[model samples]
Target: MISVVIPTLGTREKELIRLFQSLSSQTLQDFEAIVVSQDNHDKVKELLAPYSFPIQHIKLDQKGLSLSRNVGIKYIKGNIVTFSDDDCWYKSDAFEKVQSYFDQHSTGIACFQIYDPEKAVYYKEYLKDPREKVGFLELFRKSSIEIFINLSVVDKEKVTFDEDFGLGAKYPSGEENIFLYTMHQEGYKASYVPEVVVYHAKPSLDTRLNNKAFASKGPMFKRIFNTPIGIALLTLLFLKKLNHLEKPIPFYLNSLGEMFRYKKSRKR
Candidate 1:
């Protein structure tokens, strides 16, 4: 059996409907849908009441995406786990392909490709071959919003989405990357299957830029395996931005000094 987990914030009703509609058309039927909402459960209930699947709703008072995901995972009972976003819709064979891959390979994780439906026609031209397996780092390099993970065979004891990273938290990214990197470090194999596709809604340019800038800083100070090259890159990036700031030298110096302090603390 497969458990499809979706973590949402009680908004995006249109997107949610699209997601559920896609699920209803899935080629695979031996799966359960678990929706984790960070708001009133009644809203989700009313939205999904018409659906004819074994759908379960989990309400979380906490506002963090990671917290919502953890709550969803707790309610999942399938041998294979799949995650999707409320704003994304999957292909009919998405779960079928995922389950097929798991059946063929005794591995820890598996993932698929995500494209913006509005830009699907250009996906072939614009999409770069993700040379590496689908994991947290690779996902970070490509996007911040969409992540697909197969957590069934993975060591559940070691798998968790970092609450400190992702949306509604201090840093606006890196939770998925951190989780995948940690899983790899713990000796889990990850596979990427291209046939399992999902269409994610694109955010506005400003939102994308803000998230990119915010996400770039996360690896510098928050990551566990911070390297010298990573630190140097972050320093150079920060210094370049600092040079552009319309502020007094004292202000820039204070900020730089604080960054150095943070680096030192993280090293310890």
Candidate 2:
């Protein structure tokens, strides 16, 4: 059986409803869902109450995505454990494709492509490829599949999301990257199935900008490169060049705004 783990926070309830609905309609029905909501258990329960799946909603008082995921994994009892973000909706046959790929391959990690719902034109221009196998490092960069593992394989290999990096924490990203990196280091194989796709609604421009700015200088970058100052400088220079390429004035203005916000946050 497959156990789908979702680590969520204050997500859009409507989007989550759609996600659960999509999962319920999956071609493969031998799966359970485990939702770890950080201090939002009541809301998650209220929203998922209508669903007929074996969903176990766990509450985590802390506000870290990594911690929430750890909590969710503790209760998982499936041979294949799948992960999905609350805001992401899987296609009808996504899990089926994943199961098929896993059955054929002896890999520890499997990933899939992600489509942006708002970018219809871009989606048409790109992302029209079938599923294929890929290396772990390539999966680390482009694959959107959250880590799905076989519980039996856990003892043989060690992998966990790094709490220092992820959303709503000091690091704005790189949790998945670090997890996959660790898995690869432990000699675990990974595959990329393009057909097992999920759709993620992009955040607003403002939220994207904020996340980007924070991610550029976040701890994840520092850990990966060991050059925080260099990364910060490069990000600043890139923002300057990007501004010149499109909207120079607004880009610099936003950069300055982000810098000020960063400084103010640091002072606190």
Candidate 3:
């Protein structure tokens, strides 16, 4: 069975409704939904009450995407685990495909693609063919919604997102990168399937630049690597993002400064 963990801030009622509508039509009924909310517990309960599928709701006073996910992990009732963004919905056969992949392959974690229904295209350019291993750099761009973990193959206890990063946390992004990189470092094999299983709207450029999204990547590189290669990777990244940013110098400097600060924090 597939266990889907969805973290929400009690906002996005319309989006969550659309998401549940998608899940309600899923061809695979073996999956369960776990909704972890920071607020509006009563609202979430009332909203999900109509859905016939088994659903679990956990209320929390604190907020942070990573922390909510970590808490949801403890309540998982299935061997396969996946995180779902409250605003995103899935294709009808998404769970079926995921379950089939885990059954046929030995990969501990599998990453798939997301499609933008309004745009009529994949969210981004993904691999054209199947990949046996997702590299460090590729994992940086991978979204959490695209990832699925088979607990029977991975060490379930060690699979967690860092609390310091992600949507509501201090740095406000890159927690997924740290999560996947740590999984790879722990000897778990990851594979990418060139298939679109989820649907989400394409984000605007303004949202992409919000909450120090680019600035946090530098510190994330540090968390992924212990050696000087982290610096080398940051230089490569600077070159890539520089071509599009209106102010590349500040972006680069912010990344570099944040990385150094993160490194210092690790020491004390």
Candidate 4:
């Protein structure tokens, strides 16, 4: 069975309804959804009541996306696990495709394409040659919503989302990257299926430009790998933003400084 775990702040009732509605329309119906919310359960309870499939609405006072996902992971009862956000929903054949891929590659993590209604293309490079089976590095080109993990592999590896990263945490992103990287490091195979399984509504440009989102990368790299990786990442980030920002150099410097600070805190 495939288990869809969603970590939500319970604020997007309209989006949640749309997500559930999409799930209800999936061609494959052998999945369960675990919705982890930080807000009162009553609000979501009413919204979820209309679904035909099984859904477990879990509420917690804690507010980190990773924390909520970790909590949902503890209660997962399916052999395969996939994550979704409140604003995203699956294609009708998505769960079906996921099951098909996993059936063929029982030991591999399956990744598919995500369509953004607002954007002409999302992750264009990664989207190309969807039939290609990629390694740890290639998986970085995708997001958590685009992947379906084999729960047996994860359980054996004893891996969970890092509480320090992701939405609602100090670091607003990179949890998915770190998670897939860890999986690859552990010798798990990652398969890229040339299929669009999900769709994400575009986030605002302000959210994308939020310094907190990029700031976490420095510390995350330092803590997970080393200072060299952190430095390299910061440098690469600078080059990536070289043409777009007015003061990319200062931003990179500040990121490196934050990395050093985080590294120091780790030693203490």
- The residue-by-residue lDDT of candidate 1 on 198-227, one tens digit each, is 777556434543434334353534365555
C-alpha local distance difference test of each model: 0.64, 0.64, 0.86, 0.79
Alpha carbon lDDT at 37, candidate 2: 89
What is candidate 2's CA lDDT for residue 45? Answer: 84
All candidates: TM-score: 0.78, 0.75, 0.93, 0.91
True-structure RMSD, every candidate: 4.9, 5.4, 2.2, 2.6
lDDT of 2 by residue, 64-129 (tens): 777677678778778888667778888788778777867887766666666676664212123345
Model 2 misplaced stretches (Cα beyond 4 Å): 121-137, 143-147, 152-157, 203-218, 228-268
Among all candidates shown, the one with the greatest lDDT = 3
Candidate 4: list runs displaced more than 4 Å: 118-120, 204-206, 263-268
lDDT-sorted candidate list, best first: 3, 4, 2, 1
Judge candidate 3 at residue 227 and give its lDDT: 31
Q: Rank the candidates by TM-score, best first.
A: 3, 4, 1, 2
Residue 258 C-alpha lDDT in model 1: 34
Can you tell me which runs of candidate 3 are displaced by over 4 Å? Answer: 204-206, 263-268
What does candidate 2 score on TM? Answer: 0.75
Candidate 3, 58-138: lDDT as tens digits: 888999999899999889899999999999999999999999998999899999999998889788788799998888668
